[model samples]
Target: MSRVGKKPIALPGGVKLQIGEELQVEGPKGKLLVPIPKGITIENKNGTVEVTRESDKYAALHGLTRALASNAIVGVSSGWTRELDIVGIGYRCDVKGNLATFTLGYSHSIEFLLPQGVDMTVDKQTHIVLKSHDRQLVGQVAAKMRALRPPDPYKNKGVRYTGEVLRKKVGKSGAGGKGK
Candidate 1:
């Protein structure tokens, strides 16, 4: 038996879910849908959502489906949030409307056009907060932003996830010596 598949997910307030070929969740934030795979069944009763598989043959998929479905439900209710921090001297981020402009120690500033269903907030010029009802979309957008200025191993400077720990590498000392 899959432990995660057997666990019941509770729906929070203002959230409504419907189970069909796929699971549809709607709330104040937004709506999310999770496709139901073969040998999997979902039930919504008493404000709790449950997922079950026909047999152990789908143990892996069963747990994965449950996790995905639960995330969808929670996403519509409380929603999902991702944070990113830009590191570097003079590095700043400004968001207006759906476009975010970044100045990350580059010759030219970079602008990112946010797709639908994702919103962001910039704090203190370097900290960024992203919100969305779809977990996967939110994560993908954050990844793309991080890729723009990925963390450098030596300097450990660049965009990084909130509270992310990185291993810093020391630079070699300058020594000018000629061999005979």
Candidate 2:
């Protein structure tokens, strides 16, 4: 038996869950759907939810179901946030409504259109805050934004996650060349 699968997820106030082919969790923040895989079953008892498997063959699915359900529950209840920072002398980020304009020392500024479920805010013109009701979407959006200009190993300049540690690579020195 999976330890995570055996644990019951406590339902918070104003949150409701529906179990079917997909688990639908509705709460104050928003609603999230967690697809239920085959050989796994979910039960809602009292104020908690539990995931179970039909047999040992479904051990993986059991844990997966529980994790997805838990994420959905938490997502709908409190939502998720991902923060990013732009590092450079002239790099900056600006958010106007659903559009975000990034000036990463590029010849032309990059304009990124945010998706429906994701909301972005910029602070200090270099910090980005991405919020979403779905944890997966939050991570995906952050990754896409980071991919725009990943941190350079040698310069450590680009978009990076908050608190992300980067190792700076040493630049080459011509003094190492043989006497000419």
Q: On residues 1-180, what C-alpha lDDT tens digit does candidate 1 reach at each position?
A: 998999999988889887888888899988888899999999988988889999889899999999999888888878899999999999999999999999998899999999999999999999999999899999999999999999999998899999999999888777757667
- Model 1 error, position 90 (Å): 1.2
What residue pairs are clashing in model 2?
Answer: none
Q: For each candidate, what TM-score against the reference?
A: 0.95, 0.96
Q: Considering summed lDDT, which 10 consecutive residues are worst modelled in model 2?
A: 171-180
Off by over 4 Å in 1: 174-178
Predicted structure 1, TM vs. truth: 0.95
Error of 1 at 96 (Å): 0.8
Worst 10 residues of 1 by lDDT: 171-180
